[model samples]
Target: MKFRSSLCLRRTAAALAALSIAGSAFAFADDDARRAILDLRETVKAIQADLSVSKNAQMQLMTEINRLKEQNRHLTGQVEELYNALEMEKRSTRDLFGSLDSRVEAFEPQTVVINGESVTVDPKEKQAFDEAVLHLQDRQYKQAENGFKRFAAEWPKSPYRPDALFWWGTAAFALEHYKTVISTQNQLLREYPKNPRAADAMLLVGSAQAASGNLKAARATFQKVQKTYPDSEAAVTAKARLASLGK
Candidate 1:
């Protein structure tokens, strides 16, 4: 009986040891599964962060593209406006000269005297004036300058004297003889202040002074346009230029 009881106790001890080994294996499996789950969660979080960064970069790029497109559109609109303005100016200039041409043809007049008595002439003084005008129309600047100069020298006190002086200045400006341009334009402004050409002469003086690198003189001339001929075209142009120069 004692030996049988001892064998029974030994079998019981073996069964307890097997149960403890099975419980340890189960715990290790649980821990490995938990570790795998945690790793997967960390991988998912990292992927989401990368995706967020990519989305933000794409959005910023799109915003910058839209801003650049808007600036380009504004610049294009400004360019179009400038082109339209230039075209209108060209059309207006053409129409003005066309009307002047027609009027000149319709009102061709005869000779008129200033101080001298009437002299027999085959062609009127108007014919000489027309010839000078034709030279100007043909862009024969030197010939036009000479013709107008001769007209002024011969008919010093003639009614057409101021017009001749104005044309002479214009021709000299076209020839890039800025000194002569300033001299002729100054003569008109100083000597014939009430003449219609005087206002235009002031503008020519400013232009000549500016071209000759005399900014102070140009500003003075432009200031005179504002003070003396405030409503004239020269004054309007001077205001714009002065504003551009921060004056």
Candidate 2:
């Protein structure tokens, strides 16, 4: 009986050792699983960090691109404004040059048709004559007289001389200066006898004489105009004057 009891105690001890070994192996397996899970979590965290950095970099790149685009747009606007300003300046310069050229051209002599004759006249002479005629047309008789007098004095050899003298007498007659009309018309008839204005000047002389109360001298002058230029318009005026005198 003692031997059997000892053997049973030995078998119980062996069973207890086998159970402890199994428990230790299960504990080791649990520890290994936990370590593997921790490693996987670390890897996932690293990947997340890298992805965040890439996203931030992409956002910064996009912002820089947008800024550059805005800067380019602003620069383009400025360039367009400058181009428009430059074009306007160029046009203004061309206009100024054209104006200056026209002004210079006005001072040069030009061909003009006067009294059915084409003549080249000095700019100053033309300007003076035109201004005198303008005064006459405007009925500024006193100004007309002075301007014609100046023209006669300045351009003594001009083709406009005979006409100027005739108009001077007419201007004097309009002002009721009878003696001045007589003298100017007589001078025109004496100096330019062959001119087309001579008969007109003689008729004006006769009228001025009639206005000055020299009826006998006016009649004689009218008869002379009719006898000298019978085919002229002045002769017709003289005939009317003589008939009126006879009445």
Candidate 3:
């Protein structure tokens, strides 16, 4: 009975030792599981923090994009306004230049026809000649005479000189200044023998001599006109005058 009791004690001691070892192993396994769960929770918290930061950064980026968009819209409006202003300036400049060119053209030299001949004259020169012709056309004989005389003296090289001399003699004859008429018409015939008005000047000279009671010289001049310019109107008029004066 004492040996059986000792055997029982040894079996009980072995079972107690095995049970303690199993409990220690189970405790260590539980601690390892808890640590693993804690590590996973920390990883989850860190990911959440990173996600929050990223969300905030994304929001900031969206705000910046909107701000840049607003700035671009404002700049586009300003650019359009500047382009319109530039166009207006260009139009105004073109108009100003056009006006200036017109004024300059008015003062510039012009080509005109005088006495069936094309000639270039300054505006002032043409104006002066036109005014003298106007005086003659108005039958202001004294003024016409003076104007033509002045034109001859002032513009001796003018293409209008021959016409002016003829008109001067015409004015003098209208006023009964026969000597002046004779002298002026003689000058025109002498200077411009091939002039368009040469036959007319010769006829006028003959008329002046006849009016001053020099019929012999008048008849001679009229005969000369028929001989010199047979196809002219002055030649036809000369024939009529010769018939009136008899032979």
The TM-scores, one per candidate, come to 0.50, 0.62, 0.59
Best by lDDT: 3
Relative to the true structure, candidate 3 reaches a TM of 0.59
Tens-digit lDDT track for model 3 on 47-122? 9999999999999999999999999999999999999999999999999999998788779988988778799877
Task: Tell me how far candidate 2 lies from the true structure as C-alpha RMSD in angstroms.
Answer: 7.9
lDDT of 3 at 217: 97
> Candidate 2's residue-wise lDDT over 192-242, tens digit each?
898889999999999999988899999999999999999999999999999
lDDT score for residue 61 of model 2:
99
Error of 3 at 236 (Å): 0.5
> Distance (Å) between predicted and true CA of 141, model 1?
0.9
Please report how far candidate 2 places residue 57 from its true position, in Å. 24
- Overall lDDT per candidate, in order of appearance: 0.83, 0.90, 0.93
Q: What is the C-alpha RMSD of each candidate to the true structure, in Å?
A: 21.7, 7.9, 10.7
Name model 1 segments beyond 4 Å from true.
1-124
How many clashing residue pairs appear in each of the predictions shown?
0, 0, 0
Once fitted onto the true fold, the runs of candidate 3 whose alpha carbons sit more than 4 angstroms away are: 1-107
* Better candidate by lDDT, 1 or 3: 3
